[model samples]
Target: MNTLTTIERRAMQAISTDSGRMLIVAADQRNGMKAAIKDAPNGSDAISREELAEAKADLVRHLANHAPAILLDPEVALPAIVDDGVLSRGTALVVGLDASGFETVDGLKHTRFVPGVTPRTARELGGDAAKMLWYTRPDRQGLDSRVAGEIRDLVAECEAEGLLLIVELLTYQLEGESDEDYAAAFPQLVADGAALAVACGAKVLKLQYPGSAEGVSAVTAAAQGVPWAVLSAGVDHETFIEQIRVAMAGGAAGAMAGRSLWKDSLSISADTREQLLTERALPRLRELAAVVDAR
Candidate 1:
């Protein structure tokens, strides 16, 4: 039904459906993905890489370490976190673009971008899917046709290169912007890359956090005519679960998250949340998929 339902999609699904099981650690932090992984959840201990070895069931995490309490850091230190025996273990490590190239200077200080993890030199440091972030307000860098074309070409090239290029439609609407600016960018981003994403082997269309049902609804609507899976922006844990529920409720395809799961003091005492996904979220996703299928 959707495009590129290849061996990879099967692999993506074998990890399980995106109900509660599709929980990606929200590494896109305030400072960036690196800062986001500082503390995973509130009122709990951070979920460390060592603890992650203990996480059973389906989980999509950005590979990163954490402080004990009160912070989060999600910048992927190395691509091997996902490629080298990591995703093979069933954890979808959403690798980021090159960090060494993404940062810039601000006033007397420098601002570093904490994307999934920058594309590195290691050949084994490959990603399940490549993610690209376009800034709307602060940089407005996403608006350049040259940059846009480069991104578009990259997705296409990844597939041609036998890799998958999955782009994330992200934004933080600052500078007295209207909701229109937020809503306007997605279609164009998709229009610019849809064929390329599918042709290049991307499995899904990951969207930024839509602040309201209307914004998320727009995402779902835009995705309806396209052949890609859609998801809302990844926020906090409580909100992340709720957002997944609402997107499923709204008949969205699924979601891609970065900060909520890893940006906390995560001491998951029990698999209650994991059990909830199996018991509650998965069933609900099945229903949503059915609704979309019926259409």
Candidate 2:
């Protein structure tokens, strides 16, 4: 049997309940949240940084109660949420290490890390785990090697700091690829990405739903027994619930999801957003938690 380090155990326990399944709520979105808030009714085309930070904090204050772990952007929500005492005891905090933009290199998109917040820094900031989202395209030459090296370096940093490393792997279409084609190819892409993350030393995997039981099974197998969870990918609430079921049935430990749980808040007035989150979003999270426990 594989042995877990002390920090690894703590990190895993933070994300999981006594049942050992992780029902995590992710609000680490940056660009997408800005767009949603800007596009809301009577909303501005540009949302100030301060406004965005407050919005994210509000999300944490309301949603953190529903999950064992809350994934947050360190730059936007961490300090405020910590100061506000929003995170309940036993609720693990996972901080995002990647920055806001994607870098296009040779027609494929690559993620960039935020400056000065390495795994060690994240640990110093009281993060139970450090998360990074990596864009992958298995068909592209040399991209895999570059991503592997990046993961290796991050893994070493996390190990040195004794923090858990959660890698969220996503794939983008190659230039000229149609949206339909990309959607159809996503399952295989996720499978390949999961294998790569495991090989490169990811302690936990936050992955997009693979769209089918078989696809989820394949991706889980590729994880090589490492704990893996599904992301909501901004799907509708009901759809995301089904996704959690399928993923857990396929051997995923649980889910780390956002957008689907709270995106509706963006369409309403700010005054009413909290009401909607309570009425619509909170129940969805409870239902997903039930699914994870059931699995």
TM per candidate comes to 0.54, 0.92
lDDT per residue (tens digit) for residues 209-234 in model 1: 45456655655555543323334343
Tens digits of per-residue lDDT for model 2, 39-148: 54445456666777777766766676667988888777867778788777667888899998898877878888988788877877779888999998765634357888
Best by lDDT: 2
Alpha-carbon local distance difference test for all models: 0.41, 0.81
Off by over 4 Å in 2: 1-3, 38-44, 141-144, 179-181, 266-270
Query: Residue 72's C-alpha lDDT in candidate 1?
Result: 18
Note each model's CA RMSD in angstroms.
Answer: 8.5, 2.2
Relative to the true structure, candidate 1 reaches a TM of 0.54
In candidate 2, where is summed lDDT lowest over 10 consecutive residues?
Answer: 38-47
